[model samples]
Target: MKKWKLGMIVAAAALSVVALAGCTAGKSSSGADDKNVTMWVHFSKEDPEGKAMVQNITAFNKENKKGYKATVQYIPRSGSGGGYEDKINAALNSNSLPDVLTLDGPNTAAYADSKIIQPLGKYITKKSDILPSIIDQGTYKGKLYAVGYSESGVGFYYNKKMFKDAGITEAELPTLDKPWTWDQFNAILKKLTEKYQGPAIDMQLSDHSEMAIYSLAPFVWSAGGNITNKAGTKAVGYFDSAATQSAFKEIQDMVKNGYTTISPKQKGFQTGKYAMLMSGSWTIQELDKQYKDISYGILPYPVSPKTKKLVSPTGSWQYAMSASTTKTAASGALIDFLSAKAQMYRTSMANTVLPARKSVSDEMMSKVTEPMRFLIKQNQESGHARPVLVKYPQVSRTFAETVTKATYYKENPDISALMKKQAQEIQQYLK
Candidate 1:
C-alpha cells in the first residue's frame, strides 16, 4: 500500500447568458408594483434541465397572481477541484445571496446550521404531501430547513444481457423481495469476474470522495456500522470497527482475487466495461444512450449477514431561502412554486431525478422504464437518509479520508483514536 494525496483539478466553465439588471440584488420586482425574485441554481445554463427550468419559471410567473417573477442565475459545478464551498461562502457573506437556491444533500446541514436559510415548514401547506424520508434530509435539529426537490439512491446495477451470458437466472439477481447477503453478493461478483475479462464490479474511489462514501454506505449500514452517530454530531467508532474493517478487507480481497477493480480514472458505468457498478438512478440517461443492448436493473445494497436486512443510502437536492433576503414572502412563494406539481414536472423533464413527493414518484414510475422504476421503489421503501447535523460537511470529509486510508492501508486505522482526534477538531469549529 502506498500513501497517496488526493489531487485533481477540473474547472467549471461559466455559461454564456444575458444578464438581467434587477436580478443583481436579491430584491422583489422592479417598480413599486412588480415583485421580483432571483434564484441562484447549481446547474449549467447550457444543460437541458437549465433551459427547461427557465421556461418553467417564466410560465409560473405568467400564472402567478402574487405578481412574483423569478430570474435564474446559473452556477457551474466545481467538479473534482472543489471550489463550490468558496463560491457559496462568498455569496453568503456578501448578503447578495439568491432569494432561493439549491444545495447538495451533504451540504444542507451546514447551511441550516448557519441559520442563513429559512425553514419552509412554517409556510408550507403541503408538508404532509412530501415523503418523510426525503423531508428528513433537509431537517436540522428537528426543524425543517429546506424542501427536497430530487432524490438519488445507491444500488448495484447489473446488465441483464451479461447475466444471461453468465447463465445466472433472474431469480439469482438481487432484488427487493430477495436481497443479497454479503456472501451472496461476493459470489455473484466472483461469477461476473470469471465471466468477464475486466473488473467484475466498478467501484469509483478516486477524486470524488462522496461517490466512494455513498457507494460504501449501504455496506456500513447493513453491517450495523455508521460513519457518524445517529445525530451526526459526533464521529462514530465504525471506520476502524471490526465490521467496517471486515467490509474493507472483503473489498480488497475482491480486488486481489480479480472480482473488482479500484480505479480513479475509469469512465462511469455508461462505458459498460464492468458487469455491475455501484451507482444511482442519475446515471440512467447516460446508460440508456451508451449501452443500448444491455438491459439494466437495480437492487438495494446487499445486507450483511449480521444485520439480516438491507440498507441503502439516500441522497437529495434541496431548496432553501437565504436569510439575507429582504423579501421573505416573495422567497416563500418561490419555494412554494418549486414544491408545486408543475415544477416537479419540469424537474422530471429536465433531470431524470426522482421527485421528492411520494405521489410524484408513484406517477413517474409507471411512465418510466424498468430499472428506474425499481430504483425509485427501493429509495421509497428501503433507503436510509444520511444523518443531518451542523457538522455534516466536516464529518463527511473526515469519514471519507478515514475510509480511504483504511481501505488502502489494509490495516484498520485506530478508529477510536482517529475519531476522538477528529471530534475535538470538529468541536472547536462547531463551537
Candidate 2:
C-alpha cells in the first residue's frame, strides 16, 4: 500500500554487514525449530489487514500436513514503513531476522540485491494464476524474490451526483477501452469547477509521500516517458525527457487553473466538496462505510492526448523468505500458502485491496461491488509496476518531492530543471 523506507545508515552498512555475517546469519537469533516457522508483518493484529493475515496463518497452521507450524510477529508500521522498517534494519545488523517477512513491493530489488531476501520462483505453486503485474513487481534480476498477496491500482473516483449536476451525461463518461484524453478531462474539470465555484478535484497535492509516485507515475508512462530506463540503471535522460516534463506540466496546470487544490479539505470528495478524487482501492471501503450517502463511480485514468495509452500504477506489500533463515523449505511453504488463491481472496475481501491472483478476482466478481470489479478490471488490463531498482526508495522519494514542489509552486515551476536536478541526485544511487 505504501513504499518502504530504508535508513541511510542501514543502506550504507548493508554490503559490509552481509559480507561479515555470511550465510549463517540469524541462525542463532531466529528461534525457529525445524518444525516451526516464524514470520513478521507490518500491521497490528487488531487492524483488518492484520486480522486477515492472522486468519491466513491460522488456516495454514491447521491445514498444512507437512508437519510444519507457523507463527507471526506484528511489528505494525506507523507512517511510511516507520517502526516495522526500523526493526527490520536493526535485525539486519544483529542477525535477528524472522524466517518469513512482509516487505513493500518496491523493496524486492533492494532486499534481493542485498541478500536480505531469497528468490522463490521454484517455490511458488500457482505462479501462472497470479496476476502479471503482481509477479512483475516481485521479480528482480530475473528471479522471483517476493509475492504480493494484494495488488493496487489508482483511478479517478468521480461523484455521480456532482457530475449529473454539472450537466454531464452518462454517455460522456470514459471507459477503459476509450479513456478520455487529457484535454477532454481538463474540459470536464472546467465544467465541474464552474458548477461548484471552487477546485473540482482533490489530487492530494499536499502529501509528499509515496502516494505521489504511486498515483502520478502512470501519467508519465501514458505519455511515453519513464522515471528510469528499462534496466533501471539511469534516470538522467528519462526523468528529464520532454514527455516527462509535459506530464508534470499538465499536473501543474491543474493547480494553476484552479481545477485542483494543493490544500484540499479532509474527505473533500466524500463530503461532496470536490467532484472527483484520484485514489486507490483502499478508498473504496472508506467511502462505502463512512460516506454511504455519496454516490460515486470509478473512471479509468485519462490518457495522454498524443499516445492515448492507458496506464495505471500498481504495487503493494508482499511476502518474502528471509535470507537469514536456515529453514528455506518451511519458509517458502508459508509464503506460498499465504499467497495462495483462498488466502489472497480472504485478505483482499477483508482489507478491500485488489486481488493479486486472477482466480481470486474471478471468484470475487459476483461478490464485490461494481466499482471494485471495475478497479480489478483496470488493474488486470492496465496496471504498471513501479521501477524495480536496488535504490528504489531514494528514487521514489526524489520523484515524490518533485511532484510536491511542482504542485505547490506560486508560478509555473521549471519542470525540466526540477526533474533534471532530482534525476541527477537519483543517478548517484543508480551507480
Superposition TM-score, candidate 2 onto the true structure: 0.91
Q: What does candidate 1's lDDT look like per residue over 1-431, in tens digits?
A: 12232221111112212233323333332235337887877777788768777777888788878888888888876765345455567666545676788887777777877777867777665788777777888887787888877777767787777878988898787778778888888888888878876677777655446666666766766787665566654443544466665565565566666666556236545556777777777777777887677677776677887776777778777788877677778778888877877687678657887777777886796688887888778887777777675766665676566556544534544544544554455444342
lDDT on C-alpha atoms for all candidate structures? 0.70, 0.89
- Give the distance in Å from residue 25's predicted Cα in candidate 1 to where it truly belongs: 10
Please write out the lDDT profile of model 2 over residues 324-357, one tens digit for every residue: 8888888888998999999999999998889999
Residue 27 of model 1 has an lDDT of 36
Angstrom error at residue 276, model 1: 1.4
Q: Which pairs of residues have clashing backbones in candidate 1?
A: 28-36, 29-35, 29-36
State the displacement of the C-alpha of residue 377, model 2, in Å, after optimal TM-score superposition. 0.8
TM-score, each model? Answer: 0.83, 0.91
Say which candidate scores most in lDDT: 2
